[model samples]
Target: MKKILFLILCFPWFGMAQGDGLSSTVDSLYREDQFYVGVTYNLLSNQPKSLSQNGFSLGFNLGFIRDMPINKRRNVSIGLGIGYATNSFNQNLLITKDGAGGYTYSILNDSQTFTKNKFSNQVVEVPLEFRWRTSTPTDYAFWRIYTGLRVGYVFHNTVKYSGNQGDIKLINVSDFNKFQYGLTLSVGYNTWNLHLNYNLNALFNDQANIDGIPIDMNTLKLGLMFFIL
Candidate 1:
């Protein structure tokens, strides 16, 4: 009768010890000192009618977060990162020639009429996000998702005109308002993640005037992310 009573008293204590050990291991393994680097691909999904040609932009980022407890098996984190992105586009042009006989001839050229009219831009961005995990926030083979906002600025914009190859359109931009605002969504398993993002800001600043034509830019991005810790 005494042995039975002792075993019952020790059972809860043994279970509690095991649970504490697991929690301590998780806490140590997923400390704030770790870091991650990942890649992103973005596509221009929304744009004004004037800007018909859009392309895929590729980018990369490195980040770190301090984990905060939410539950025994899950946690949340605040993460920050910086990234670089570049996308290029070649637009088609219709050409018309005046004949010697005072008649007009139009040529529908499938070829890129502007051999040099292609345009490209590079952007630098900062991301602030919240990450949540189904298992320990930093554990392997766990399901996770992060949704956040991003602010990006265009550092470089260059357009090569088809009619004039040597004279590239130089756009001098200075202002944070010219920067883009967007939402970022991601899903991951273990160390691998996939992302989709949409830009909420217009491509061209309100004051931007190109040949008296203003353009809006928006993009959709699909990419894979590899987490580093």
Candidate 2:
């Protein structure tokens, strides 16, 4: 009877030991690729119809992502990452300070068509995604779709204008929004993917006025993304 009881007690421990060993083996076989870099072409949308998009706006991003497996299949994960991004806008905008110490925006006159005009911003962003991929441990090429949200804080901003008259550069311009949030989407196969972002917040604060009208603009970005495993 004592031997029988001993076996009963030892069986559960043996089963548990086997279960732990299998779990560890599965963990050793799991593959996680956690770094990616991307570049985007930014399109300024919702602008005051008066402001025209004159040239291509470019942006670049680099990030480190942590993937948390949510199921036994290891094909679905929650991804969290932090990254640095910068964007430049090429447009013709006339910004001037009024007597009341307020700033105003207007379209550049035909005679003053600037030789170069652009606004640029640098930001740090955090992104969270619900990711799905059809991948196996041995497969390096797979289809994936990642949808998420991103929040960013602008750390630097500047406007540059160069014309026949002269050159003007302003740093940390007033009325520029410091905080922004957006929706992010990435979908594709293998090393290259299609990425898109739609910003939900206005580009400028309510205090930014043009001809007594408040300026409200948003951004849209679309480009190719590359991943390294």
Candidate 3:
């Protein structure tokens, strides 16, 4: 029969369609993978009595998070990420290279004529977060709150001073604390989120001092965070 032959010929296509649908469903049920980027206003805190910030300080970071859902509906999960960040602080704490192959620290006066004085850090960072979201596997737009800890190692540093002292660039600041750790919180809707970081440790080691008083400055960042799948 022609009708029976037609049904037989179509069976393979029908099975193929069903197979594709099943595959898509499985992929949709277990996805929380995202890439994120952020820009921040960096602030220094716990400063020495004479040190003060002068200009704008900035920071940026980007990374990917591996999301693992723990609940059946997939709204709760944990994320671990590795990223890179460059943080800069513009302040009056001045650092100059001493002739003995070390560094000297001082607080600049308000009347000092300097075009720029700042220190920047290049860091390799890791973040671990506990995430709660109003998102389902199939939803693309939702609200989320992620709180976590971020730890980093400062691999490189630079200090620049120009003005009364002329142009001076100092690198490999030996007195800097190479290890940095902080608390992070990010919360918001679909595309825009507010992010904050409060660092718990000093920016420099105990050996970095001003007139025998240790410099115990820390950093706080406030900014926007964006995520993409």
Q: Rank all candidate structures by their lDDT, best first, as comma-separated numbers.
A: 3, 2, 1
Q: Which pairs clash (backbone N, Cα, C closer than 3 Å) in model 1? A: 42-221, 43-220, 44-219, 45-219, 45-220, 117-160, 203-217
Q: Give all TM-scores, in the order shown.
A: 0.61, 0.84, 0.86
Worst 10 residues of 3 by lDDT: 15-24
- Pairs of residues clashing in candidate 2: none
| Candidate 2, 1-229: lDDT as tens digits | 3653354345335434533444322343464546666778899887775688788788887677788878888899898988888898898776666679767788776788678888899999998988899977655568899999999999999988898658878889878899989999999887668899899999999998777777788899998766654
**What does candidate 2 score on TM?**
0.84
- Candidate 2 local Cα displacement, residue 33, angstroms: 4.0
Model 3, span 110-193: residue lDDT tens: 788799999999999999999999986556568899999999999999998898878888887999999999999999886668
lDDT of 1 by residue, 125-212 (tens): 7877777766543344566787888788778865445453234453433311347778987787655567766788766555443334
Give residue 17's error in model 2 in angstroms: 38
Clashes within 3 Å, all models in order = 7, 0, 0
lDDT (0-100) at residue 216 of candidate 1?
47
Best by lDDT: 3
Model 3, residue 189: distance off in Å is 0.3
